[model samples]
Target: MQIIELNQLTKTYGGARGITDLSFTVEHGEIFGFIGPNGAGKSTTIRTMLGLIYPTSGSAKIFGKDCIAHGPEIKMEIGYLPSEVFYYDNMRVKDLLHYSASFYKKDCSKRIKELAEIMELDLSKKMDDLSLGNKKKVGIVQGLLHKPKLIILDEPTSGLDPLMQQRFFELLEEENRKGATILFSSHILSEVQRLCNRVAIIKEGRLMALEKISALKENTYKKFKLETLTKVDASSFAIPGVTEWTADERTISFLFKGNINDVMKKIAEMELINIWVEEPDLEEIFMHYYVKEDGSRHEHVSA
Candidate 1:
């Protein structure tokens, strides 16, 4: 079941740039990664779904209900953590949790305590006295305490340490196992690659590609680097599927998209000192979709 859906969703600012004709869906009980570089339409798309911002065109739906018309009803079953954390300075952590929990119809004390212990949060500290990381922890706890059916996190690990980040992932996984749907947005490729079952790559407010993580790894291009013992003209080896070739003296690196056996046979004929094949990370793939030669958008993803 698709818990969230965005169809031809477009948002335009006075400057005439935001998400464009973007469409995607999140399945129930799945971790969906919304990934892109900074200034990409990630936040714009997220805000539109939350009804925090109205779209210029198109529509968004959560659990089959129109987002704009049914935001209050849908939000009751959703929990959100924004990229930045904001809290009342004079309020203690516990007080803030209590206040946030009060908004929900059910008690969240047990869940809040469990989340606090897992996050190693100190509830006695005043918001003004806490560090940036601690403030983020409070936000996390508040989001998870309600045990909502849908959780939307934007750069959720911004201020967390490595240990805390690991714990957070575990918590998210646990929530997923309990039948919650999640849409997490982040620039950290490895985290998304590791946690998400499916990912949607957005660039300049457009949806570039959407695929299952496994399928993407299997079908995407591979990077091969070879250090030849003798100077070799790498240009002679170019093939139909291969793209983005670069060479410097005896070292050559390029993305290969054909059969591995054929590429290996060609390389074996050369006097290679060292050779390695690696898959491009999500960040590298994102760059390919966003950055332009003249420092402008080269390819715009459809919204």
Candidate 2:
């Protein structure tokens, strides 16, 4: 079932700095990614969906109910972690978790303990005394303790160390197994690539692309670098799908599209010492979507 849906969602600010014509959906038990650079409309869209901000035009729905008219009902099942963490300074980790748990009807103590162990968080520490990363752990614990049906996380792993970030992914996987729907927004492409099966890319308040990660990888170009035994000019090989080429004596590096067989065959006819092909990572794919000179959005395909 589609847990969340946006229909031509447009939320323009006084200076035209918000999302425009945004449309997407989050299905039940699916991990969805809302990806964009800083100043993109990602946060605006999220706030609009949460009914924290009203859209200038269009509609957002959660569980078949209008978000604006039914925010309280929708919020009951959502676990939201905003980009910034805020809490009472004097509150201890345990007290804060307990306070948050009070808003829900379910018993959350067992989940809280489990999250703390996984995150390696010290529940006895005062909020004011903890470092930024530790405080984020507290936020993570609070968000997951209630076992919300829908988890909406914005830059959720910002302050986490590498190990803690890995653990957080594990926790998300566990939550997914339990049938939670996730809408995770982040500028970090790698994290999104790792956790999200489908992603929507937004830029400058506009939706750039929406597709499955596997599809994006399949459709995108690949990079190739070669060191030939003899010097060869690779500029003639540049084509529409290919991009930037750098050549130094007998070594060349460039990007290409379509079948590698023809390109490799052509290169094989030349004197070649060694060659390597590198797949574009998520970051590279993301840059291609959001950083184009024309500022146009591409419709990404699902993997």
Candidate 3:
């Protein structure tokens, strides 16, 4: 089942920046990655889907219902952790969580305790006294306490240490295994690569690509690096598949996606000292979308 949907969803703030013509979907039981650098409309798209902000054009749907029209009902099944967290300064962590849990129909007390222990969050600490990381931990605990069906996270790991981040990922995986759907948005490519089943790449307020994580990494660019015995012309490496090409005297490098033999044959024509051919990771593949000249988009997956 489609858990969330966006169709030509656009939001503009007059002269200010916002998302445009964005479209995608998250499946019922998959972890979907929404990735882009800052100002790329990651947050705007999310806020629109959550009904925090109305779109200037088009629409979004959650649980097969129009988002804005059914926000209250839709939100009941959602667990959301914003990029930044703010709370009453005087309240203790436990108090804030309890207040948040009050909105739900079920009693989240026991679940809150379990999550707090797993996250190693100190419930007695006052919100004003907690560090940024601790504050983020509270957000995590608050979001998951009700055992929501759909989890929406925006840049959720900013303040966590490596160990904490690992724990959080494990926790998310556990939830996913138990049938929670996740929509994770972040600029951190590595984390997204490790956790998500599929990803929707956005740039400059536009939807760029959507594909399964494995398929994307498999069919995308391959990294090529060679050190020639002598000076080489950068133009010599400008094959049809080559992109983000660069050369400095005896060193040359670029990303290629076509038949390996074609590129190898070109390299064979040159005198080289050493060479390295490697599969490009998600991060490098993502860079190609950002820096490409023709502005061509990758294969789009149907929402």
Q: Tell me, by TM-score, which candidate is best.
A: 2
Show the lowest summed lDDT stretch of 10 residues, model 1: 294-303
Model-by-model lDDT, in order?
A: 0.86, 0.83, 0.88
> Which scores better on TM-score, 1 or 3?
3
In model 1, how many backbone clashes occur? Answer: 3
Error of 2 at 164 (Å): 1.3
Candidate 3: 10-residue stretch with minimal lDDT: 294-303
Candidate 2 positional error at 69, Å: 1.0
Deviating ranges (above 4 Å) for candidate 1: 220-283, 286-303
Question: Tens digits of per-residue lDDT for model 2 on 11-91?
Answer: 887986788888888899999999877788788888999999999999999988999999998899889888889889998
Highest-scoring model, lDDT? 3
Q: Is candidate 1 or candidate 2 better by TM-score?
A: 2
Quote the positional error of residue 271 for candidate 1 in Å.
11
Q: Write the residue-wise lDDT of candidate 1 on 1-303 in tens digits.
A: 889999999999988799999888898988999988888889889999999999999999999999999999999999999999898999999889989999887888888888999999988889999999999999999998988999999999998999999999999999999999999998777788789999888877877778787765565667889999887775778666566778888998888766788888888888989999886765566554345667665443322
User: Model 2 reaches what TM-score against the true structure?
Assistant: 0.82
| Candidate 3 local lDDT, 181-235, one digit each (tens) | 9999988777888999999988778877887888655656778899999988876
**TM-score of every candidate relative to the true structure:** 0.81, 0.82, 0.81
lDDT of residue 236 for candidate 1: 79
Give the per-residue Cα lDDT of candidate 3 at 168.
99
